[model samples]
Target: MLSPSPNSIKKAFSRVALVGKYQADGMQEHLGDLAKLLGQQGCEIFIEASTAAHLSLTAYPTKKIETFAGAIDLAVVLGGDGTMLGIGRQLAGSQVPLVGINMGRLGYMTDIPIQSVQTILPQIIAGEYEADTRTLLAAVVLRNGEEINRSLALNDVVVNRSGISGMVGLAVKVNGSFMYNLRSDGLIISTPTGSTAYALSAGGPILHPRVAGILLAPIAPHSLSNRPIVLPQDIMVSIEVVDGREIIVNFDMQSQTHLQTGDTIQVRQSEKTITLLHPRAHSDYKTLREKLHWNEYPSTF
Candidate 1:
């Protein structure tokens, strides 16, 4: 197990906000237990408003998602990666660090297990943890030189066919230079933090968080040779809709908008980043092995 670095911050996370996936089973019980634990540790807890609506957490103080900025020092997110991702976006520019307790399958970001929270969380609270800062991809949709929509993604920005009717033809450009064009089901532009998510399923490489690159992976391209590539994080990638109907673009598969044939989507690295606090022993390779079951050997036939 990796130990907490000697330079770990000391008692820096006191004011904490607790956010959870409201629809999860036993949410009330879990939230209550967690809130009580934080109080005992001499920490102030603020519950996110939406989560309070779903559960009877009336005894504790509640805060809206928008009010989290500048109000809290840390956020303890309880749920899967989806929960973490949602909260991460809201707290992105605020730089309020987040710690995740896993409550769902395949937790790449929500690394701490529920059973271990009682044991591990306190260590983190007491200044024994590691911190990881992840970058975001900011994208804008433009049509006829007019900006239409804009959003930020901690995972990826995808351009895809909206329905089963046809494939989308997209022309790729990097820093104003043309790259290539292809007709495919979709294309995924991912950050290093997202290389393990949908991009991994689409045959993209696993990019270490320390790598200064962005990943581009074609989803089921018509040509088998169209492969995934990592581009310099400093460049802007422009994808123009060359053809096809019912095309769309989405931010981390959460927010989406329809596309016109002449529209262009511009994506680039954002100046904002989200800070993630992990148990001092957290290691990326160890996490991959445990989550992907990399150590499991197959039975001989």
Candidate 2:
């Protein structure tokens, strides 16, 4: 479980922003009700522009995410973890706390269910909550020794085969030291916050969100000896695609870019961090047990 820092307690979230999936079922109603609740508590509310358009909500002021940096105090995401991942990358360095309302399957990050929003939201607005900070990965794609693209990920950065069905060769390096060359279908570089995401599906270990480490998990590795490895948070990782293979690099599964044979992708811990606000009752172990259906039955002695 992540403990809240002293500074994060009793934060005055007077201005709040709402971001939700476009046209999701019952999204309009949930967002409307949430806005009303916050408003009744004397908190100013802002709706993300696209969400406002989809819900035809003109009651609250609509603003784009880029404009939320200095103006908004808190961001309330009303979708699943995917929505939070996208928005989390944007708000990583902004120091604006986020609260997630689950509207999608397997809401690891979006823990707050829609049914409990009414009950929990009041406590959160009154500063009865715990805030946990999670790390993010910064990736830079280089072609011919020149940087081409850069992106941030709150979950993971995936380097996988572009179109071919065959395996791709990737040379892994950490802090300029060689690790190993992996020939696999793909590779996943994940943060602790992303341990339960693609990494878990690829046989990576589940890491606590507060753990300061990065995970490198091979996807369908050709050899049994190649296994997932966890590295210290401060090291830099470089993965270069071997010749004659085309690969695609994905950031948080939200954005993608094609990579050439000689292209290199450098991933390191980002200087920014995402702050997640959880209710006082939040427990990572309980969440994991519930989400993964673990230890569901009582053991008989």
Candidate 3:
């Protein structure tokens, strides 16, 4: 639940969009139920075109992902965190809030469980929820001083060797100043929202989503002295392949592009942000403890 300030004004939502994993078991049934619930609240429901096709649902209005911009007040994503990640990137900068329903294991972003959908959705539609604004990273791949590719990531931007298996040499710079050079399997430049994802699997620290910092974690560095670093969000980070090795750059694990020697990747905080709606009782610590299985006692305790 969001604690409202004295100056805050509550806005009523009348248009909602649904995005889900196509063809997943029981997805159609869940979508049907959700549509009915939203309709009862006097809200206009829209479904993503592909999802509507998959479920053969033509009763509600349908729109393409890109075309649906500005036409929706909120988006309800049904699936795991991956589904939320995709939708978040697509709907970035649109200022449309997202509510994720957990349909997969270890759903950190998708906080609402399947069993609780009936209970939580009503509260949410009634405006009894909290809106958490999360930061996003903007990455640009530059070659010869020209922008070649640009992407927005809700998680981390990873640079690593593509085909060859050995470690690759990388040079890192922060705010146009030399930081360090290292030979490692890869590098992960992650947002606080991403700290719990790939960064954690690579032995990086878990950062609370509210923390305004960027984490730089090296993956299997050849030298033990090359450690992870956390920097303020306003700084710009540039990474270049120094060993003349071909590498790949991945954005939020959703898209990838090849990088050659001397190709530079720049990452900085995006001007855009994603608004995540959570149930009033949502707790970041409780979600972490449950998802990571932290502090669990044995039967004997």
Candidate 4:
């Protein structure tokens, strides 16, 4: 169902890695079936070590997620967006591209459907696909002007109250200029790739991946006047936890750490990036329409 990009050269993908959702029931059969499919394509299949341990995938070689950078040419993910987000963060700066076989409810990043993998995946491995490069956010937590924690978030960086009953006061600054001071549940600083995630849920505008902008949405701001704003992607945003009962910071909703009141989170564009491979014919609007169920006509109409 997917076609190769006409503009791309025929690249060799002799080594392919398969990462599957280990928590799924009957995942062994799913991974086995896919491994068999890739093996038939004359490819050397490498299973992720963590996945190999969880699933009974001993038939293929295994590689750790931390060191598989150059050994593998391409990675095929068999999970939903959450899995992709985790892998994407880990694979940042690897320069290795990824193709996803969607197995989750909302497959924004993992766009390919499992049912279509049999038909669409082979063409992709054979070097017929479009490469969509997405940027990432690099965040560092500074406690007393000393770096304490650092992480990369492909989706968003959320700083909010830890418990159910409390408000966190935050001071926001963009590019060294004071932006605002607010008391709210927390804040969402998201990349364009993250606009559709928590940013959208928190009443933030959806920024297209191509847009070089970062979205800032306050969670339950005490003042209704506090509105979401989009910032230049290149600007460095510094948010300091002023006052709150308990504050926590999250990277891509995957890794999180508790923070002190004086902690300042500095977020900037990461030098590392992620490359997602899709069919050459893939359209952003089409994915949006299908995934979001847009442009539907009423039965009465």
Better model by lDDT, 2 or 4? 2
- lDDT of all predictions, in order shown? 0.89, 0.89, 0.88, 0.88
How well is each residue in 182-233 modelled by candidate 3, as lDDT tens digits?
8999999999999999999888999988999999999988888988889998
- Clashes in model 4: which pairs? 4-128
What pairs collide in candidate 2?
none
Which of the two, 1 or 4, has more lDDT?
Answer: 1
| Better by lDDT, candidate 3 or 2 | 2
> What value of lDDT does candidate 1 attain over all alpha carbons?
0.89
C-alpha lDDT of candidate 4 relative to the true structure: 0.88
Better by TM-score, candidate 3 or 1: 1
Model 1, 1-301: lDDT tens per residue? 9765433434567788898888899888888999877776677889989898788689889998788888888899999998888888888898689999987565889999888899888788888899998999999999998999999999999999976769989999999999999789999999999999889999999998888999999999999999999999999999999999999999988889899998999999998899999999789999898877886876652
| Candidate 1 residue pairs that clash | none
Provide the lDDT at 62 for model 4.
97
By summed lDDT, the worst window of 10 consecutive residues in model 4 runs over 3-12
In candidate 3, position 23 carries an lDDT of 58
Model 2 lDDT per residue over 215-249, tens place: 99999899978999999999999999995466799
